[model samples]
Target: MKVSAKLFIVGSNSSSSTRNAVDMACSVLGVAQLDSVIIASPPIEDGVNLSLEHLQPYWEELENLVQSKKIVAIGTSDLDKTQLEQLYQWAQVKPNSNQVNLASCCVMPPDLTAFAKQFDIQLLTHNDPKELLSEASFQEALQESIPDIQAHEWVPLWLLRYSVIVKSRGIIKSKGYILQAKRRGS
Candidate 1:
């Protein structure tokens, strides 16, 4: 039996905890790299919160991984027109795509659409919340399920996704999640 594979994971911990997530994902998936990882993050810079100054560090890190052949492509979630423009203009390795949550807005913003077309940056639509698997919710769920466990002592770091495929079929053979949990507060 022969199986080929591809996985694109949407995640909310890229800015705060990318390394941990990547490490865990690599271990669980038994693979060296992911085809794509669309990371969730909010703008956190002064003045123009969505400027290159805010996003450059994160994207550069991802870019380094790409240059080192760790990840094939890096994408961002929930960036609007001006933010994406800032990133595109300043990044050494331009993002392969940007993901917009349709739930937040019924349709893509016109400015974003136009910019994406001009720059050829793929715009993907997602239904997932901007903050997927928030720490408080994940902890609450775990506490309910396992009374012995101190859920608060463990932080929900991130998620890793993997897939197996049959090349001829062009369909996924299997897929799974590797969740990163970091222990804290003794």
Candidate 2:
């Protein structure tokens, strides 16, 4: 299956980490060979905080990336309603299969999910850097928690997204596995 995966790397402080996350997300979405990534630096250029002015450059790239009919996974921190709206506008161009991979600390603005729903975009949230771990306890915890969770809740997406981040960060301490996306019309 040819799954289109889009990864937005927000607050990527280093080139190496950013590259690894992109590579891992691509693998998870079953499109590693395709390399469809969108790197969104935090709105703040020199710090962790968000500054709208700083995101202009990223906006251009984001607009271009979402033009495809592939699934997009955004790896970002918290965003307000306005920022989320901007993202929705960009992703709406193609619609259908889109995933927003965000940090655990970054709660989905009330309207982000609603906005995405309009286009059938799946808003996926992930763990912050501190939560990326491959320990047995972590796996066990996830196994126990996922079933009871609702899609609107953040845990499900957080775990899945974190796994990709862990692999990309080279912190998994094991060989990585690729996630294949189901192909279109399959």
The best candidate by lDDT is 1
Q: How high is each candidate's TM-score?
A: 0.78, 0.38
TM-score of 1: 0.78
lDDT tens string, model 2, 29-105?
A: 55534323333334233445565445544444444444442224432334544655565555433323333445433
Stretches of model 2 off by over 4 angstroms after superposition: 1-52, 62-77, 90-109, 130-186
Stretches of candidate 1 exceeding 4 Å from the true structure: 1-16, 42-51, 161-168
Candidate 1 minimal-lDDT segment of 10 residues: 1-10
Error of 2 at 116 (Å): 2.3
lDDT minimum window of 10 residues, candidate 2: 151-160
Q: lDDT for model 1, please.
A: 0.67
